[model samples]
Target: MIDQAKQLREKMLQKSSKKPSRQTRVIAVTSGKGGVGKSNFALNFALSLTEQKKKVLIFDVDLGFANIDVLLGRSPEESIATLLDKDLSIWDIIEEGPKGLQFISGGTGFDEMFRLDETKMNKFFHEMSQLQGSVDYIILDTGAGLSYENMRFILAADDVILVTTPEPTSITDAYSVVKMVQAKDPNVHMALVVNQCTSDNEARATAENFKHVTAKFLNKEIGLLGSIPHDAIVPSAVKRQVPFVLAYPNSQAAHAMKKLAHGYLKLPVPYKLGLKGFLLKILFK
Candidate 1:
């Protein structure tokens, strides 16, 4: 596994060091706290991106949680942990979700099936570079935390989409994440998704205030990607192990997700870095 990882690292360095015609768009969808519906947003947003004719790969890095796989009604036999076996590659672990969308599970280390050493895991990490070139977008649904594991993944992305609710605590925690991320990379593409908003007015008010607060305190311009309304269908879809957008494409929340997808595509990308650049930084720096 470590050998394969090293080979991948070399290839990435060779590619990223030189200029490229285009850079793949990578979005790290994270939050200040849990239960803000970050996973739901990530899953449906990937589907929406595919709807826009973009090839999307959703990586579930939320430790111990099986949100994406469960939501898609799938039980993946392989995960990042399986790559340590010396026989499997990332292609072997990827599982099809819905509507031609795909996802990779960041295995829970608790089980024997996923236990891996540093070098072996690095081998798995190296293959991520191959993915950087194959897909149009890589949506990372990272675990909600400030730990090194979470930061490493978030910092490596081309953009960071912070999910927060209208609640005071949610906003405060989201700001903390923004601050942490800013401290790491001030130029990082930061965006906001106000979820569970009850009304259009509330969504506007909450998103605007949060944006203003981040700009005032952090001195960062956080893009207001869009907001999702508080919809019962969301929970109902969860219970049915399906994505709300696929089940209720006409729902307000689903419609909001599509708008967010389009809004994301409209955001100007910082073209200085490509997938190879992000891969090198994440692996070595």
Candidate 2:
């Protein structure tokens, strides 16, 4: 048994070290509804990836409600707004957090996002693509619901991780978002993260429920990433502006996030840069 455990550990470590073939695995963290801990999940998820020694960037694309900075207990010196004005590179706005994770704040509102004309839109994509080569993963914390901005980022990501609690409303909202995204692009790859569940069984049930509804109505497959149990340690860590994964590495929630990071390790690296590749580098830099 000891030898087997050693071999398993070695295998896991080997898998984690294998670099993703893609420039970056762009993942959009979205929820069916607000208050499901979507932003917190996004922050901690990125931090967890960093703990695994993977280079990660958190794009706080929540627009007006961006709080990734707050989650990390830092005030932003710059934001997506600076990028829009061509005043700073994406690197300029990136703030280092616990575990050496980097994060960029989303702008303050939809009006600025909507105001992006063809020139600025082109510039924005260019800068976004540039970061692809420098990071292993880019996690976008999108605002709740199925707005045009949310759909845009969801479709652009290499994968989408939908977060929801066991609440009926959260499930419904998650289902609705999935339906909307599918309607726009049927082939979108999506996964689920069940947060605030009391038990693993409850988390699995929530994931199963989402899978069934999505398959029945949208004929889409939704992957189950993992779950985080309801733990006071999470909020307690939040109060300190430290990621639970780092603030309390031995905590249950931290362990679950580590498991989720391991699960992410098994996924195939996304290699294609697409049209946004060159554009993102230029504008963001």
Candidate 3:
């Protein structure tokens, strides 16, 4: 399976080598803790990006709860583990969700998959390199908190959007993530997204307070990537297995998501290293 995927990838790479490469931004969307609506935010955010006519792929790296497929009411037969264990190309594992958003599920055995031999690891990286210029953004929906797997993706990404809420515990944990990331790599660019806000004032206050604390303690200025209001339509859409941005486009949360997408696109991308650079950092750093 590995050899065949490699041969096919090489052929495709050869054909694409001569063409101008499109720079892909790899952004990791994570949170301080679970239940902050991190995964949901990641999914809808990707869909919102697609609404703006941008090509986006959201990879669910939350090994324990790989619900990107489930959220779309999709039951994928293959996942990242499938590509690692079976005969398939990286493209084979990528599944298209609502609004033409492409995603790859984080299969079971999330920990053991990386313990495999180095050759398979290299092949995986080589396979992923094909996506360097193939998409506009690769959003990695990583697991919350400072787990080893989550940190690897966070550190390697060109930028990370840390999702949090107005709760005190959520803010504390989010700050912890910032401190850990800053300690490891101060150059790692990170932004904050306060989700499930009751009002614009509350959202601004939450984000501003977070920004203030990080700057004062860690001397790190986290960018505010806007906030999402607490709308009932979000859970209803979730129950229906549809992204709110698609199911209820006129809802307050949906409108906020659209604005978030536009704001994200306008933000300065100062650390775009493309897919290959991202893989190198993840695999070797």
Give me the overall lDDT of model 1: 0.79
Question: Which candidate leads the pack in lDDT?
Answer: 3
Model 1 Cα lDDT, one tens digit per residue, 1-285: 446445644544465456343357778899988889999999999999999977678988887565788888888777766666646766666666686686888776623323345676467657666676556777888888676767876787888889988999988888888889889889888788999999888978988898898889899988788999999999999999899999999999999999989988887767535567666666567
Q: After superposition, how far is residue 174 of candidate 3 from its true place, in Å?
A: 0.1
The parts of candidate 2 lying over 4 Å away from their true place are 1-22, 109-111, 269-285
Each candidate structure's count of clashing pairs:
1, 18, 0
Name the TM-score of candidate 2: 0.85
| Model 3 lowest lDDT segment of ten | 4-13
Kindly list the per-residue Cα lDDT of model 2 for residues 160-222, writing each as its tens digit: 899999999999999999889887778677889999999999999989888988899889988
Identify the superior model by lDDT, candidate 1 or candidate 2.
1
lDDT of each: 0.79, 0.77, 0.85
Model 3 score (lDDT):
0.85
lDDT of 1 at 251: 95
lDDT by residue (1-285, candidate 3, tens digit) is 456445645644564465546578899999998889988899999989988987788998897877888789998887878788876778777776776687888788756655667977877887788787667789998888988888989988998999999999999999999999999989889989999999889988998898899999999999789899998998898899988888999999999999999998997778568788888887777
Cα TM-score of candidate 1: 0.87
Name the regions of candidate 1 deviating beyond 4 angstroms: 1-22, 110-122
